[model samples]
Target: MIFLFRIGFLEVSWVDIIDIALVSVLLYQVYKLIRGSIAVNIFLGILALYLVYLIVRAAQMELLATILGQFMGVGVLAMIILFQPEIRKFLLVIGRGTEFRENLFKSIAQWRNSYHEDVNVNEIMEAVKTLKATRTGALIVFSRDVELKFYVETGDVLDATVSKRLLLSIFNKNSPLHDGAVIIYKGKIKAARCVLPVSENDHLPPHFGLRHRSAIGMSENTATLVMVVSEETGRVILARNGIYLRGLKLKQIEQKIVEYLQNTEPANWEEISEEEPTTTEN
Candidate 1:
């Protein structure tokens, strides 16, 4: 049997292809806006309730259908109330786009140059190595997308160049700023002793300490890179995009830093250390 090809429709309507493509793009954007957010769950719940209402109507259950129909009538208002935060966030993003268009491209180009600069990574690596060797506790947060200004304001504003000496001094055990995190932005230190939200995830390993927990919490909210050096064990841990890598060696940590700063996927940090003798403790 000869299959009738869609070439017949293609001859008549190129408009259909454009219409489908536009719809697909809109759906994808909508998904991107709502995915990994509370709105997605709320949307699914509403869909389920609507399905139940349809079933009730089909079954001719008048009382149930009437009740469901009433609820459905007010569902739009309920949804807006339930999703106020997400709706506000979406609107804020749209508003920012107008402002971002004025300066974003230039800023992105500048960031690109900084990412390729060897001085930045070298300075950071030296700091990490020294901090690890001395068993100095430190939390370093690299910001992305979400602004850390609120937390940055909580700490001393450094606005200084990123260098080994500065980083070392800031996190030195005896330093006044040793307790909190240092926020890094655009190849420089933005703030010192910045407080970070601690992760309350029940599934996190019990052995993970405060620094790791805080790093994970910050990562869960933003696409930021966080590095933590344990005071007790000197174990270097990395948290990014809600995943944690523990017991990273100096080299592995540097690689991860470069990868993250350059917007590339970090290599397997734990695997990178496998060639050497694994130390149970830092």
Candidate 2:
């Protein structure tokens, strides 16, 4: 290797600098993905062990290096098993932001999108208000860019118009469809009684029930804004991209939903949410 400079007997090259930069970038990306979750501790432990392995190998400690080397051999598979959720999220974020996806979306846009009128945000707010008033637990997912067909197929398809009465009826406690979620896409009620993935986040407050967990989980895995009406406290919660704003005023929630449907949310939403505490209605 071409040496740039030396410290005692060690030399560093441009190639080594470039390699370290790339590895640092990759590790930083991984850290960003799992920063607030439980997996962060596991990731740090693994990183510390790997650093020790490198140190041992560099010092020519044969026995310790050999043992650590064995662990490194299976590191790829171990990381896959341990960080499955984070890996999936990383891949999904990549897929969503890729030029291929953008081009694909443009091409697909040419084939569909004939609907002219927009879904009334006020109507949804009204439905949510009624649900809250009745203390009926409900989960509603709204998507503007990506149609959540995968999760939609998990329950009954409605393809009905968005209305206050319809939402109220579907979420009526005695109604058979009340047990699951409702998905609204492109100004229409795309589906009802949809099943959503439940979040395993340990940091979530215990007061959050299954409905809240499912809403958070759904938002975490997809490009969707989820609203939850608590059956216990009759409070409203909004989740998007893994961050939540719980117990906000109905008007505030309505405004956020409107922004979401308009695809006008501020960039790096999770970052903003992390820096600001949730505001509750007085």
Give one digit per residue, the lDDT tens place, for model 2 in 103-150.
344444553553334678888988988888889899999877555655
Q: Which candidate is the best by lDDT?
A: 2
lDDT tens per residue, model 1, 35-113: 4344676789999999999999999999999999999999989989987855775565457776444334434455345
- Note the Cα lDDT for every prediction shown: 0.73, 0.79
Q: Residue 19 of candidate 1: its Cα lDDT?
A: 75
Q: Which parts of model 2 have CA positions greater than 4 angstroms off?
A: 1-117, 268-282
How many clashes in each structure?
A: 0, 0
Clashing pairs in 2: none
| Residue pairs with backbone atoms closer than 3 Å in model 1 (clashes) | none
